[model samples]
Target: MTAYLTVVEAAEHLNTSVRFVRRLVAERRIAFHKVGAHVRIAVVDLDAFVQAGRVEAITDDRVRRDLSGAA
Candidate 1:
C-alpha cells in the first residue's frame, strides 16, 4: 500500500513550513486528498513534486582563474 502523509508530515518531510504546504494546497499546486475533512498527501505525490521542481545548474568553469585582485 502507498503511504499518505498529513500536511504537517509533508511539511516536515520537505523541510519547509506548514504554511508553505497549506499555501500550495490553497493554490492547487500540489496533489492532495481529502479524507473525512482531513487533508492527505501521497508520498509519491510529494516525491513527484520534489522531482518536478528539481533544477540543474550548468556553468562554464574555464573562464575564471583569478587568484589575485590584480586585473
Candidate 2:
C-alpha cells in the first residue's frame, strides 16, 4: 500500500525542517494532495523528488582527462 505522510512526517523522513517541506509545497516543487484542508505527500512522490535531484558521480579517469587538458 502507498503511504501518505503529513508535512511534519515528510520533513522527518527527508531529514529536513518542516519549513523546508512547506516551502516545497508552496512552490509546488513536490507532488502533494489536499484532503479536507490537510496537505499530504506520498512516499512514492517524495522518493521521486529525491531521485530527481540525484547527481551521478564522475569517475577519476574523467577528472584526470579534464585536468590534463588544462595543462
Candidate closest to the true structure, highest TM-score: 2
lDDT of 1 by residue, 1-71 (tens): 99999999999999999999999999989999999999999999999999999986644442342344334
What TM-score, over all chains together, does every model reach? 0.80, 0.84
lDDT of each: 0.90, 0.97
The 10-residue segment of model 1 with minimum total lDDT is 61-70
After TM-score superposition, the amount by which residue 15's alpha carbon in candidate 2 deviates from its true location, in angstroms, is 0.1
lDDT of 2 by residue, 1-71 (tens): 98999999999999999999999999999999999999999999999999999997899987998889964
**What is the number of backbone collisions in each predicted candidate, taken in the order shown?**
0, 0
Q: In angstroms, how far off is 33's CA in candidate 2?
A: 0.4
Predicted structure 2: lDDT:
0.97
